[model samples]
Target: MTRTLVDPYSVPDELRPYLQEVVQRTHALCGSDLVSVIAVGSVALGDYRHGRSDVDVTVVVDGTAPGPVVPELAAALAHPALPCPAAGLELVVYDRNFTARPSGEAGYLLDINTGPLLPERASVDPSESPAFWYVIDRSVALQAGRVLYGRPAREVIAEPARADVLTALRASVREHSSGEGHLADNRVLNGCRSVQFCRTGRWQAKRRAAEAVAASEERFRPLLRAALHSYERPSRTAATTLPTTDVHTFLAWVAERVDESSDADRRG
Candidate 1:
């Protein structure tokens, strides 16, 4: 359950082989251009659930890989060819330059989203997309990313600024507040995680963060419990749909919590 370098034990038993395949494929395909492939998110945090979680990977390239390699990488790791074993594979490719500098702005070369739960689309061109997702992801990757291939993550992926991560977490709270996120489980769990990060400066697995928040924030216990159930048992039916009004309310509370922490940091 330890989130360490190439820790296969943390990855669900069903996903270990497929994740290995991803690492092998990237090494064979990208060759020298591929500097490191780091496993981030649930798998890295030891909270991955079969059929529920996506295999999140961050690939760091040598920064010298040409534009042609982008398309080539896109084709090689595309779903049908690679066939992700988890719900989906959330793969992002970045250059060494992108990871070397520690900043608030997020940058990437390619974002390949494929699998059963995800749409089969390869998004390139960082300019077209908002930096929110990348910024949040990079923060988590720096904290918990485990190497799947090539060098160790910390050797390449620089730690993002603390203030930038707080900003990204605030953006996540705003997203859930607007009711625009794709997953209900994520909305609930991420809200808890964001508050924990805002207050503690620690990034934790969603379930653990929810549990900790629920323990101390008794008012949120029922909602956090429902969120945990949905995340741990994705295929099973929940007793009740997460109430939208309640969700918005929780997010509003989260925004305030984050704001309080941000204000505290400024004062201290």
Candidate 2:
């Protein structure tokens, strides 16, 4: 089955051919075990901007697929001939069983991100961290993502519960709370999305989520605008350059909001 969230005509013409080629190559590599290839992230959310967004993809495979499939698939897709669109490609390959009920262990067989500086691969080992799962469980993965092959996205994905959402947010906050290192612009916006989801029950792309919260939460406006500006720009260097102090402040606020939301949920 094929399911598309956005009209093919709507996507910038230049991106369409490249994205199609990527999908075709992916289908060729995964073969029969591939249950579905869904497009998540900004592209599916109608917020796609040519140079600013990454083309995110999720390839679901049969639970029983061979162990070598993932590594092989990764190598195959990582070929230099196949150029990526936007900032880069963010791809995750998940087993069907894992999609239904993700475990503490890394549910994905292959998780990779590729861009200019990191052209060949991105070392996002989900086994080492649960943050990957937190980002995957966002409602947009199922509700708005485009299915390029096999089963429809809705049939393949199991949306996380409210409790699960809170857990994920808390984990993210803890991981990023240390002020020693700076936070990426996307992480800041992701925090906004999580907080918004807890309070409003709406899933949004980063830009929209940041905008929504900035409008309502006066304290976050300047920070959110900074992030938004960075996100709109084409280069990583153009991204937000917040100081360590601001980064810590934002993370601490997110942690507090998450704690309060979780408490409210429990009390209710």
Per-candidate clashes, comma-separated: 0, 0
Candidate 1: regions farther than 4 A off: 1-7, 236-240
Cα lDDT tens digits for candidate 1, 23-78: 77777667777788888888888888777778889999986567777788888888
Instruction: Give candidate 1's whole-model lDDT.
Output: 0.79
Give candidate 2's error at residue 129 in angstroms: 3.5
All candidates' TM-scores?
0.92, 0.84
lDDT digits (tens) for residues 1-268 of candidate 2: 3333234664557578766676666666667777887777777777787776677788788875576665666766663656665767778877788777633344666777675534566443565546535354435677787766668777877776667667777886676665333336767887887777777866677788888889988987888888788887876667767655776788788888989998999999
Clashing pairs in 2: none
Angstrom error of the Cα, residue 88, model 2: value is 2.1
Q: Give the lowest summed-lDDT range of ten residues in model 1.
A: 1-10
RMSD per model, one decimal: 3.4, 3.3
